[model samples]
Target: MASVTYDRTSCVYPGAERPAVDELDLQVEDGEFLVLVGPSGCGKSTSLRMLAGLEDVTEGRILIGDRDVTGVPPKDRDIAMVFQNYALYPHMTVADNMGFALKIAGLNKSEISSRVHEAATLLDLEPYLDRKPKALSGGQRQRVAMGRAIVRQPQVFCMDEPLSNLDAKLRVQTRTQIAQLQRRLGVTTVYVTHDQVEAMTMGDRVCVLKDGLLMQVGKPRELYDRPSNVFVAGFIGSPAMNLFTLPVVDGGVAFGDVVHPVARDVLGRAGNSSVVLGVRPEDLELAEHGPAVEVDVVEELGADAYVYGRTKLGDGEHQITARVDGRRPPGKGEVLHVAPRAGHVHLFDVGTGERLGG
Candidate 1:
């Protein structure tokens, strides 16, 4: 296994005014599973392609285990890539497809057969060795693609949205399997996906990018608990954090009649009349008396429910969401009082959108 590094690497398409991937300086330790995650057109895919040698690095360099590989050919980079579409040959049997790379590399028939059988056994595809791609299920076909990579034993693995084609249930199951498989193989991997949930669940360290710039890179819980800015604060969670630019009043920010207290330093950083307050849906609780919100819709998910509502705050109507007990959700058009749990609120500077000390 090998560590990978992008030292101020950038990719700018010809004639484009701005770079697709800005100066990205990231390091992945040996045997680490690093995930690049962001929204569409966020340059996550371009970053992955640059590492795989599919795209040119317009500036800086890429290193694989201390070797400068910015200009290296894809085949010479000693990396295996798994594409989203499976990319299995339709006419070849599972065994043949898995061993095709070895065959092209001049491995003898006997050696290729041995390696193919070994990978098939590990992937539980022994029974489907002779079956063609058309005969296998989506999950099984994905396993075949993985087997193709495993037999090569490359120093680095690059997977680009490898689970996008599967159904939801299969995607979840396969993600678990892939995570377990990566740990077992211990190969340095770089995975790209637009799904934050996938990045949170599978990556050893997750990197968030926006408009080709690296926003934050940390353990899943770190990014969730302490986002660096308003963009990240609003992007990482499932329900997303509810943010309001409320007027500062009495050493706190006001949400209707409710005043959520802030640290003195945090208040000092807000040099304006208002500060942006953030509260996750799960961090909000139904209160006896707080801001009154008109319930618009209730989404029940068995274990929990999400209450979507609208409330008048600071002379304008704003939408809010709160998580409550699924079995006892409030009905539509009903008004309920909700407040942020103590010590669970996030404060940001209104002018810069950066997180304030708390």
Candidate 2:
């Protein structure tokens, strides 16, 4: 097992005006499952490639454990990469595919067979050892790819959106399997995905990036509960947080007719007449008196539902979403009053879009 480090590492493609991956300093603790997540073109993939030795570091260095491997070739990095496409050889059987790296390293047949069987058993692919890649299901094929990586017993694992190609149900199932496997193997892994849910559920810690800059890094709950900025506040959650720029009055921001009280120091740090108020849908309730939300649509999710509506706060009408009992949602075009639950509201600076206080 080994830890991975990005010591101000950067990657700038040729003719690019800006670096694809900025000087990102991050550390993946030994035997930790760290996920790199962001929207498309956010440099999550580039960061993973840099650590895998596939992309060159335009500046600074990368480390695997204590070894500086910035200039090292991909093969010499002692890392195993599981790609999105399930890069399995069509002509080879499952056993052969799993042991191919060992063969390249000149390990004898007996040892290679042992390792292949062990990995196949762990992945429940032992029954299809003699089957070719074409004969396996998509999930099975991905397992074979995982098995290939596992057989090598490398110092670190780099998985680049390995679940992108699977069906939604299979994706969920496979993700659970992979998380369990990683815990059992205890290998330091850096997984890249654009899916926040994947990053939230799988990683020991998640690193969120935007436009190649690190946004926030934290445990799933920490990032969800206390995002460092407005971008992360809106990005990490499923329904996303409802944010509005409201006039600061009486040490609080206006929620229409109501004054959503905030700490004086919290609003003081922002130093602005307007502060951004953020409340998650789940954090809101259908109250008797608060802000008036004109109901637009209600999304039913069996046990609960989300109310997507609009409200006029200050300048113009703004969108608001609130979670409510699925069986008792207000009708369309109806007006409903909602209030944010105490201690659940998030405040941010209007100008910088940064979080205002703790």
Candidate 3:
């Protein structure tokens, strides 16, 4: 296994004023599973492609372990990749497909056979070793692709949206399998996906990217609790974070009829400027005495209910969402009092979108 490092790396397509990735510096520890996650056009995939040598590196260096591989060909980099599609050879049997690379590298027949069998056993594909790709299910074909990579035992594994082709249920199942397999094999891995849920559940640490910039890289909960900017806050959460601009005056922030005290520094930054307040759906609660909201819709999600509404905070209208027990929820057109959990609130500069609480 190897640690992968990108040092001030950048990639630019011809004629584009902005690079697809800019001064991207990150490190993946040996045997660690790191995930790159973000929205479409956020450069998550571009960063991965750059690491995989599929895209040209316009600046900086990439290192695997202690070796600088900035100019190395992808095939010589000792890395195995799993693509979004299964990318299996339809004409070859499962075993042959898995062992083809070994055969090309001139490994003896016995050694190639042994490695293929070991990988097949690990992936539970031994039973279908003779089956061709046409006969296998999508999940099974994906396993074959993984098995092919496993047999190589490369220094790093780069997977680009490997679960995207599977059905939702299969995707979840395969997700668990892949995580467990990586742990067992102890191979350093870099996984790329747009799904936050997958990144949170599978990665040891998630690297969030946007607009060619690195937003934040941390354990899942850290990013959720302390996002560096408004983009990270809004993009990382389910139902997303509710954000609204509230002017700072009298050393407090006003939301509807409620006024929340702020720190002196936070208040100073606001100085007549508007600050954005962010509250997660789960962080907002139904309160008898809080900001009044007119519920427009309610979604029951078995264990919880999410109320979507609009509230008047000072002279501006802000959309609000609150998560409450699903057993009972306020109806449409009903006025409800919603309180954001104290100390769980996120404050950001309205103009720059940077977090304001130091």
lDDT of each: 0.92, 0.92, 0.89
Clashes of each: 0, 0, 1
lDDT of 3 at 132: 99
**Prediction 3 TM-score vs. true:** 0.96
Any runs in candidate 3 off by more than 4 Å, and if so which? 270-272
Which residue pairs in candidate 1 collide?
Answer: none
- Deviating ranges (above 4 Å) for candidate 1: none
lDDT of 2 by residue, 8-88 (tens): 988999999988999999999999999999999999999999988889899989999999999999989999999999889
Over 1-358, each residue of candidate 3 has an lDDT whose tens digit, in order, gives 7999999999989999898889999999999999999988888888888777888899999999999988999888999889898789899999999998899889999999999999999999999999999999999999999999999889999999999999999999999999999999999999999999999999999999998899999999899899988999998888989988887767677766677778887767753467888989999888777778999999999889999999887557778888988999888999999878888889888778888872
The weakest ten consecutive residues by lDDT in model 1 span 257-266
TM-score of 1: 0.96
After superposition, the stretches of candidate 2 with alpha carbons farther than 4 Å from their true spots are: none
- In terms of TM-score, which candidate is strongest? 2
Candidates by lDDT, descending order: 2, 1, 3
